[model samples]
Target: MSRKRKETEVFSLSFLDCICCGFGAVLLLFVLTASRKADQMDDLQSKIMAVIGDMEYEISLKDKEIERKKATLAVETRLAKDSGARLDETKKRRTELEDMLKLLLQQLAAIEGELGKLIDEKENMPTQEEKVPIPIPNPDRRQYLTGFDILGNQVLFLVEASGGMTADTLVDAAEWADKPEKERREAPKWKRVKKALKWMIANLKEGSNYKIIFFNKELVPLEVGFGRDWFDPMDPDLTVEVLNAIDDITPEGGANLEKAFAIVNELPIEPDRLVLICDGLPTLSDSYAGGGNQVMYDDRVAMLRAAQNALKLNLPVNTIMYPLMPDPGSAVHYWRLANSSDGSMISPSEGWPDI
Candidate 1:
C-alpha cells in the first residue's frame, strides 16, 4: 500500500502544463489570422462603393441631356405654328385683292355703257331751227337769203354765161345789134344775175371753202387757174378779184350743160352741193345745135343725158332758174331734174334772192 501511494496522482502536473501551453499557442494563432481577414474585407468594400458612385454620376448627365432636347423640340413646334398662321393670313389678303379687281372692272364697264347711251341720245335728238344763216357781215347792205342748207364743207357755184343772158327775157332775143356793147352788158336781167352772184359771195359762211365755175362752151374758173380746184376761206381781196373776173366775162358762147356735168365728174373730189344758175335748157351739148332759137327734141335728149350724169353723181344740184318767157318746158324739165336728184329748185319772184 505504501509503495502504491508513492506511485503518482491520477492528474499529473507535467501533462497538465503541456496541455495549457498548447491551448495558449492555438488561441494566439487564431487571433492573428482573424485580424488579416478583417483588413482584406475593408479593401473590397471600398472598391464596390467607388464603382456605384461613378454609375450614379453618368445617369445624372443623361437625364440633363434629355431635358435640353425636350426644350429645343418645343421651341421648333411653336415657330412652325406661327409660320402656318402667317401663310393663312397672306392667302386671305390675296383673295381680297382679287375681289377688289373684279369690282373695279365692273364699274369701268358700267361707265362706258353710260357714255355710249349719252352719245346715242345726243345723235337722236331733233332740232327745231329751220335755217342757220351765216353770221358774216354784209358790206354791200345786200339781203342774206338761202333756201338750201349751204353749210357744206365744199360748195360749187355754176353760173351760165351765154348770149341768151344778154336778152331782156330768157326767151326773147336780145337787140344786141341796135344797142351798144356796154348797154347790152348792163342789161337788167344779166345785172340781176350778177347781183345775185355777188350777194352769194358776200353771204358765204366764214371759214367755208368755195369755188366758182362759169360754164358756157366750157367750164372756166373765175379767179384761180384750171389746176386749182377750190378756195378755202377766200380773202376779201381774192373775192373781189373773182367778182371782177366774172364781170369782165362777155356773154357770147352757147351754154354747154354737158361740159358742166362732165367737169363735175372729172373733179378729183366731188362737190357736196351744186348751185346751177341758168335761164334756159342746154343749147350746145356733145355736138352743135341743129337750129338756134329754141331747144329741139335732140337738145332735150342731150339735157336728159346731162341730168342722168348728175343723177349718177348723186350730188344735190340746187337750181336758180331765171324765168324764160316762152319756154315753160325748160322750167318743167329743170323741176324734173331737181326732183330726180333730190335737189331744190327756186324761181325768184319780185323779191328775187330773198325768196
Candidate 2:
C-alpha cells in the first residue's frame, strides 16, 4: 500500500507539452521543405520547356531549308533536261545544214566546170583577117555587105533546110521537131535564116548568075526546073519568088552535106564560089544510112571529109554558121575549110542584116 501511493502519476504535464512542441516543430519543417521543393520543380520544368521549344524551332528551320534545296534541285534538273533537248535539236539542225551546203557545193562545181569548158572553147576560136569591100552599084542599099566580097561570077548558095535550122540549139531543135509545120516556119531562128538568105541574094553582084539550092536529106532547088541551072540576079521578080518559096518550106529533115556537094558537082555550070549556110556538121550521109540517131564525133568527122571530097571543083567556099548545141568542132572545121578554100566564114549576130 505504501509503494502505490508514492508512484501515482506516470505521464506528467511537462512531458506532454514537450512531446507536442516536438510534433509542431516537425510539421512546420516539413511544410517549409515541401514548399521550397515545389518551387524548384516549377523552375526546372520551365527551363526544360524552353529547351524543347528551341530544339523544335531549330528542326522546323532545318526542314524549311531542306524543302528550299529540294525545290532548287528540281528547277535545276528541269533546266538541265531542257538544255539537253535543245542541244540535241541544234546538232540535228546543224547536220541538215551541212548536207544542204554539200549539195550546193557540188552544184557550184558542176556549173564552174561548164563555164570553164565554154571559156576554153571561146579561146580556141579562129581569127579572121579584114578584107577590102567590093564596089557595088548602090552602096547605100547594100551597106550591110560592106566587108563581104562576092568575088565570083558564078556563085552557088547551098542552104541547109534541116530541122536544126528551126532552133538555135540541138536540144531546142529536137524539142521543136515534132511541132506543127506552121510553128516551125514561124520560129525565130528560121525567120532569121530566111532574112539572111534574102540579104545574101540582094547583095549579089549585079547581072551575076547565081543558084540557090536548099538541101536536107535530099537536094531541093527553088523550082524543079532550076535544079541544074543558074538564076539571073538581075530578075526583078526572082527575089519575091524565092522568098515565097522559102516561106512555104518547113524544116523537117537531117542535113546531108555530101548529097548537097554531089548535087553541086553535077551542076551544068561549075560554080566559082560556093556559099554554105549550115547550122552544124552533116548528120546524114550515104555511109551513115544504117546508123542510129546518135552520131559519134569521129563518124561526123568522117562524114564531113566525105562531103568535102564530094566537091570536085576547087572553088572558094564561104560558110555562114548558125548556133548549134554540142557542136564545138563545127566552128573549127568550117573555119579551116573556109581558110583552105580562100574564102571567109561568118557567124552573124542576132541583129545582123537589120531587117
* Alpha-carbon TM-score of each model against the true structure: 0.52, 0.56
- In candidate 2, which residue ranges exceed 4 Å CA deviation? 1-147, 224-229, 288-293
lDDT of 2 by residue, 1-355 (tens): 5665566565799888999999999999999999999999999999999999999999999999999999999999999999999899677656645554564476568769999999999789787675787777744224224344465689888989899998888789988899999999998898999888876676677768887888999988876234424676556445445556778888878889999988877887888878899998888887555345677877777888889888888877888899677788888998888767667778889887564
Tens digits of per-residue lDDT, candidate 1, 1-355, equal: 3555477686799989999999989988899988889988888888888988898888899899989988999998998999999888667656644544454466568769999999999789897667787676742112113365445667888888777777646345455525665776676677778877765665567777788888877777766544554776446445544655667766656778877777777777778877888887877776444556776856665765664565447776778888645666777777777666656677776455431
Q: Which stretches of candidate 1 lie over 4 Å from their true place?
A: 1-146, 168-172, 177-181, 224-229, 287-298, 310-312
lDDT assessment of candidate 2 = 0.79
Residue pairs with colliding backbones in model 2 are none
TM-score of 2: 0.56
lDDT of 1: 0.69
Using TM-score as the measure, the top candidate is: 2
